[model samples]
Target chain A: MKLVAVTSCPTGIAHTYMAAEALSEAAKAAGHELEVETQGSAGLDRLDPATIAAADAVIFAADVEVRERDRFDGKPTVVAKVKDGINRPAELIERAVAAAAEAPAASTPAAAVPAAGVSPATKAEEGASWAGRLRGWLMTGVSYMIPFVAAGGILIALAFLIGGPEIASKVNGGTFDGHTYKGVSDLTLILNQFGVAGVMFKIGATSFSMLVPILAGFIAYAMADRPGLVPGVVAGLLASAVGAGFLGGLIGGLLAGAIVLQLVRLDVPRAIAGVMPVVIIPLVSTLVVGFVMLVVVGKPIASATNGMTGWLNGLGDSNKILLGLIVGAMMAFDLGGPVNKVAYTFGLASLSAGNLNIMAAVMAAGMTPPIALALATVVRPKLFNDAERKAGEAAWLLGASFITEGAIPFAAADPVRVIPSMMAGSAVTGALSMAFDATSRAPHGGIWVVGLIGHPLLYLVAILAGIGVSAASVVALKSRRILVPSGDAVAAAAPSSRGVVAA
Target chain B: MSQIITPDLVDLDLPGTDRVAATRALAERLVAAGRVTDLDGFLADVAAREAQMPTGLEGGIGIPHARSAHVSEPSLAFGRCAAGVDFGAEDGPAHLVFLIAAPDGEGAEHMKILASLARRLIHASFKDGLNQAADPAAAATFITQEIAA
Candidate 1:
């Protein structure tokens, strides 16, 4: 038998892992294959969906709520207390095996089944609004696309760093200030003639070219699983062909995924059903999506993209600073969560359309939180706990490197004081970066890519000002208290295990 | 890696009627070894955990533990009670007692060690070996080997 289990305890320390080990040992002794996921204070190692899909039975040995329990919806499952798993593993395994044998084999391959544990689109049952679901789907697409962004973005930055920012402008047939984004022209010629800097820029730009398709493909993948991929990518390429840009890709992806999801639900004859996912679904959905993209929504989206890009490019200095405040607030609002990703995607969209200032503002705002928090800890050491103080020491490097999540521990501990302080600081920095006429071709890489930034000195100055303002505000907020009890000061100064869970 | 437990922290013959006495005896070794900085504060933390629910388990074992600011590191001290201590397990009094101490806040190393030890305690062979060990050194070494495994 192939068995999978999730073990958790209230304290999330000892018993969670003890149950996992006991279950594993008993499963091995009983000649069964078992994989156990331990959810504890150390953090959970979640079982992959592929593993869950392939399992014969599921066991939940949790004294507390099991996270993502719906993933095991259709599997034969045995629920038991956390201690029962440790002391009676053999009995639990016996019961699990019995449960598996009593259940009928699923007719469909587990991976092909939808609407249960498969995708975020199925979360409508949980009472999520349409807007929330839409955001989840869009965030899914953007998240998968970020690696390509970081890789391609940094490589392009490196190209500029080596070849003096003008090196990449050759491939686009224009300079940064007033040129339209014509996609990269003369790719093979550029590669053959341009040497090392040319190779970096061309390779990086080629990766950038895939950004729209990947975004479209994954958004579809998030909605309708594997079957949604082909149609989604096809529509994305069509969007690209029509000059519809990233905005068109987003619309096309939603259309393709929704179309495929409904098409797969068609009840075909048993004889022909086997080919549905591979042949009929892909072929039919792709054809529909392609037709819609070529004829229906393509041109409107392209005009919207061009209009947004033209507006971004034509912004006056005051408007740019205003845009900076909104972007900065979003970056610090969640401190590297969904809202931050949205701001980042906005920058990538502008970058793809050839508006360079938004990305510079984005990077500056993103870099402010950790640096500011680190600075706060130093100015008033009594404001943070020892663990936070240690984290703050590491935050300087993390912030400078543009890893915004380095400040999560602090924000999680004291969100009310930390997040707004960070927002105020980041807003100032973002506005200053834009007002100083700073621009970046790079999507990310904070201080490391200074040489590639337009007016590097002013960019640095903006960052320093933001850090100073944020640190001072955080210290001030912490020192001046309202509803906070006198006990807050004790928690701040307390040494080890004050926050640690007792086992 | 710092040694979480040494032979000096083990007791071959521990005397106590209840879980509190047995736990304190083992904890005293931690204080003597400088693994714990404050005995009364650490004991109060352990008592709080005990009050949450009994730390007793089936198969004659009791683990009284807490994450205390008084603990210098994550440490474990062992005792073999001559007369079993009642640890609230339905099975009966516990003969093998372990006092687990973790430094306050999120320290990783000792918790991993202690959690791994908790897993190993389920095996009859491992538990029996500890019960049959000839000396304190043998008992501590047996635990270290089982943890390493």
Candidate 2:
């Protein structure tokens, strides 16, 4: 017998697809033709009306309520929890079929059965659950957001490269006058005039800036399934437009998803299902979530974000020493994970605001851990395992290029000691460079690439000092082990278990 | 006389073996129990199916089952081993065995049975119950209830 199945989960991450997979495999094994519609983070992946019509039975394995149940008024329908779909789908289907067959024919009146239309099935299939739909919408936003960071960074780099050094010159000891830099001033004019590119870049950046809201929306979609998508997207858009950025988006997405799901469970007529996705759901969700974000949540969140950004940007001059320590510690804390990204993003933003000093400090702190670790391993092989020693050799180049991720392997292996040591060394470097009034033009790379930096020689000196401190600390910790031959040490320190071992 | 059992029946003892060698050994045991007819044929059938795709299902379980003409009748020979068998899964290993034996002619009914078994396995508690089942009869009874429910 042909069967139609719908699978969804609360998180819409793993369980949704897992249930679908189980059902498909079981059906294949049982010699029955089956079609499964998955309501997941990506939205309604597979929804074929013909399959539903042809099926001898229908199974709904979901945590969230499904929309357009009226379509299956006369058909055999089995609604079970997602867990049941995973653990007992065959049993559930058989039971559903039996239940449908045994039910009185009078229970579903012929007049009550709505004509099978695309809207009801479409709404049922796509808007069946709010969480899954929300996830899909939010992911769509995130996928579009990444290009902004890349484009903005590259354009700003070009602007700085063409402009003369004086373009970076401070005005009245506070503001920066781009007019002073002749080459860059001309280039900036031309770039600013490329209205289309500027608009595209702005939109991308603005969209990218709304990452938090999008994430929230997707999370909700994953929970609520198809019906959740409409509310989730609406909530995310509202969050972005109202200045909530990340926090507001998350709240809005969740609110929208929950509201839509509640409405779907009300079991409105089949005729209304078609209009729900495009009109009724979006209108209600936006009106509710938009009002909440704008009047209630928007102001506080905007103030908080602005306050945070201001606090971060103000970490210069007076508190240069403390700021350096914090930046340095954060960079080495997760190597290149969220903490490091936050610090790096803050420093990069500073470049646009004409405060290159923080960037200089950040660049110095960023390279310290990997460079220091590499040098430490080279000077004293006893401090690291054979695998780490070999990794250190490659890390030297990464350090020189200011790729902080190079130290991840070493940190992952021994986070406790390595992370603290790297943070201490980095913090020291950041503090010293900031105190010396060092400035950088670029967001990344070592002192070697900081030729355009103010006081380039000082930057190099600070980097050297940080590297020395890191190496010394590591050596002090590792001096107990005897230094083995370089070749043997390299063989012993293979990075992965799959690495070929040499005699 | 050494009985030649097909690979179709041997592949059923998946959850009963942790390695290829163990799986082969379980296949031999099933042959001794008269649950499988031709050992080579059963193994060949399993190898062929595995080459196409793995039988690893969701919920940390795997079902390595096959059908062949060598089998005289439809049967289920289950084996529960101490260690989890590595069935070349993307995530890990196989922990449950439900070897289904059907004649090559048993077409759609075989698929229906597989589907029913798969649907029941989607439940976490059901899987746990299967793993904790005291013996083969208990496991079979649990499975039968799951299919019926």
Candidate 3:
């Protein structure tokens, strides 16, 4: 079978080529003809009309949205991330082939291919292991949750930076029922302030508050698709209201997803099943999840959350640093995988309780991997390829925004070296942030909200120091095994590609 | 470009311990095929490109390609390293090697051919066909047919 593929990434460098290369290799090895067009920084290497016409299927492996996607409208297409293409090219190819074979013959050509809006989840999950499916769902949640966190956190931090330390109380002086602005000793009351700072503060806070619910909603959407959204969001809001925090959001999302999944599988009448997703499933699941959260598990979860926050607040400086180290390691472990989510969730869980130090540490650690990788590439240019070096240039902005996903390509390429280096750096940053008592008013925003951080200079220093450690470690680790063969002048002149050279 | 690679350029068993040696050996074949004008200059360019990123890929295939002033035309030389050549890929060394050389300033054609070769290399069966081919002529025919697809 003939197959055509397009590979792209936001950076449009490493992963794009990597995925293209992987797909091409896999297709050839499988004895199927394949052609890959790379949409990269260097620009489009478009698929020839002949190849496209002859192709039985199309594969889209991209992080950023693909341009001209409509070209494949009538073709059997397998859509996935560039990472998936690189890691599981054979599998993606197989799915594309199968999808092409399964296209219904009775329907119109346009209708025979799945609708434009159809998600790739079902098709991609056809042969996926349970663990793989779960990972996919969680990753989808995290990917969706990032935009909200980054935007909200940055805006909130801007508010604090512009409006000063007493901004929250100044903006909402009379409306607070009982929430105290911790560390604000001045207590400046600017009732109904409509200044620029005041407006910024209010808007930022509003966005910041939606963080948990959005996370839950999207997580459920990932699990059971659209039907799980309403219930998951309602459960998340309840979790926030009852002080269950991120953990509650996770539980709520999972519960909503599971409920929706089961509800959709029920042996209902044809007419009922048609309306199930849009009407019955959503309404029933929302009501059920909300009822369970409020009546059954709400109080216990809230108290548990409160207890945890209380314990964290009571920790001594050394213990806080230790906790910071652990959290930092977790954040760098999988580069936005489940382990990183645990650290991020812990930070968000404590956020509502005014324990900003943990959040500060978590964000700092989260920012380390990308920043360190970028720095490593800069310090030792030959250690990485042209695409990687280009990607590193983009990592700076991504890291500053606290997008841990920026380090994914590097980690995906060489996890053993990259992950360990990142972890060490993140741990150092997390521990130092806690030890110094540097705090951020926002959960994310990285260096963009630097002005809002308590002891901003110290925080910056801690982050830089971590980057240094990680960069140095990565360079050292990489260069250690790189051996150039003697007697080959050309080999001696050229940079060694593999660190481990066979004798 | 379909005829750029030939049986004369296909070596069933090439000896090389690493990328530099392997690339040099393949570059030599392109010179013998009258595809390269200056063997040393072309080989140097290939080495420089390889240094930028090891062409060693998943499934043990190495595509060391470069556009150089030393090239007379676009060409492809195939090499099968029995002992494997280290191209620095995290996975492992490469057993199937393709040295692609194109005239300087003609990047489009070079990239097209490389892309084409990359797609074919992805299939296990295609790689197996090349690996199990009895002679250089058979391997060249297999590659030519695959690329034509």
Candidate 4:
């Protein structure tokens, strides 16, 4: 059978490709041709109508909903969890083949039946429940906001590197009447006069200024599509103007998305309805969001933001260590999954509030997992294959750059052993960093920002210690055990000896 | 769609030591019934899929299927192994096995039957009905009727 399949996951990273690969391999083994389109972090690999027309069946192996699934209505279909596709592709394919044979001819091909465990409504509702849907919107916003954050942060880091920490104040306080310097040294005077690094700093600051609005805009866009963008951005700007931070951006995004979605659903005459999405809806929604943010909610949100930051700033040493441990474990938990995102976002919010230590601990912990895995591969070569060893070599660079996603392959392959090992290391690092009172001024630069880090030697010690623990533990655990999918669940039920019945 | 399986395609009790032997045994039955034109070609396709991933699911079921040029029509072969065949599932070996085969160029029709069979297989009652079937005819009737419904 000629088959077409789509694979996606909430994070749109490793699992998406793994499921796609599994499906294709199964299809080939079955002597059937298959094409798999992956909707992943990188973007979409679209399946054309020609492929759909020729397909005997369609398989949607996704945790997230398969976009444009209606296109497959004329084909026999099987929808299963992405993990199930990885585990039971042959069965899924057989089911699809059977459905194809039973479905009537193309004259009335509309009766394509859903396989077991999937209904059309449920498929659409994959992440449609209130909280899940909200999470999806936030993730969309985060994904879109990442580039701006990276660019702005790296530029600011560079500015600090070249012009020193005093640059921000110096650029404002120091003065030069075109030729004469006042209140600064020669280099500082000249540098401050020309504002050479200052330009880069200002541009970066400008980009940082856009972060909240962009996050808000994209979150709303994810919820109501393009119609929500204008109001969301405007509301975010209002929040920023009123001294509201990430929390305000989040609320503004939600409010704008809701308002715009409601507006989109409003009944109107044909000509006016046609114009509404392009003009009327955006205009009305933006005004509404602006009023809500500036007039009603601004002061309350600003005070809440201040209170949150103040409380974080006032945390005692023990509380700080506990907070760091929790954040660190979350960062390593899924290796850039939603839990990791929550911790990282919290760190960013803290950075905006001038608490550099939280960001420092978060980044250090985030960087530990992949680095530890890479170290483990070197320390115990027998535990990993040739391919994995090669991957470890690349992981060194990814870890140094603080891309937590570098550990995903290892975690995906052996979550049972790798994740806990990673979490252990990260928690140690986070807690130790906090205990040592290490702080980092730069939002990100990985090891390159070691110069900007407070208690640099102890910070390095904390990181190395974490690497040692994670590397040793992961190697030990993996050697003693096999990586069963959802192995933890199996382990919890070991006494019962009823694996199949648990599900 | 036409009946994809018959008594000729059913084996109430198949004795095979492993997945390969079981798969080949089922494919041979299809060949013997004139449903398959090239036995080697068809078996090769089935073996290729088994090598890719073990078809053993969580249950005691192994579904090994192929779409091959050797197949004359879309067909299903059922085998109940009293002695289990190891299909390399995480849980264990498989006792109830299904071999789905389809001829080349009949993709749509093949998938329709395959999907219906898959949907019915999810129910424990449906599996129990197949397990308790008296003979090949009874098993075939049970499978065909259940899928049709």
Query: Could you list the iRMS of every candidate?
Result: 2.0, 10.4, 5.3, 10.9
In model 4, which regions exceed 4 Å deviation?
A1-136, A169-195, A269-275, A305-431, A437-455, A463-503, B1-149
Identify the leading candidate in terms of TM-score: 1
Q: How does chain A of every candidate compare to the true chain A by TM-score?
A: 0.48, 0.43, 0.49, 0.44
Q: Please, what are the lDDT tens digits per residue for candidate 1 over residues A1-503?
A: 89999999765556777789899999999999999998876666779877877788899999889997876776779999988898789999999999989877633332324423444321112134454445445555655565555555556667765765555556555434344334345666665666677788777777667767876887786567677789888887887677555656777898988998787667789989988877998999999999998888766645654654455445534488888877877688766544566667677777767778878888898888888988888888877655567667767765775656556546644557788888889899888988998988776657766766898899989889888888888888988853344333223231211111101
Give each candidate's fraction of reference contacts reproduced: 0.38, 0.06, 0.09, 0.02
Judging by DockQ against the true structure, name the best candidate. Answer: 1
List the candidates ranked by DockQ, beginning with the highest.
1, 3, 2, 4
The reply for model 1, stretches above 4 Å from the true place, is A10-13, A41-58, A64-79, A94-223, A235-503
Question: Model 3 over residues A164-186: C-alpha lDDT tens digits?
Answer: 53455555552111244443233
What TM-score against the true fold does each predicted structure earn? Answer: 0.50, 0.37, 0.41, 0.37
Question: What's model 1's lDDT at B92?
Answer: 88
- Residue-wise C-alpha lDDT for candidate 2, range A1-503, written one tens digit per residue: 67788887543433465578677777776777778876654356455655554566778888776655544544567888776666666677577557646644422111122234522111112222343333233333333222332333233233233432222231111223223222223434534643434333334334344444444455355335445556676666666675544435555766876676566445668899778666876677667766786778767755655665566667555687788777777777766544576677777777767888888888888888878888888886766655466667766766765656556545644445567778888888888888888988765535334665789888888888888887777666545323432222122321211111100
The clash tally of candidate 1 reads: 3
DockQ of each candidate, alpha-carbon based: 0.27, 0.04, 0.07, 0.03
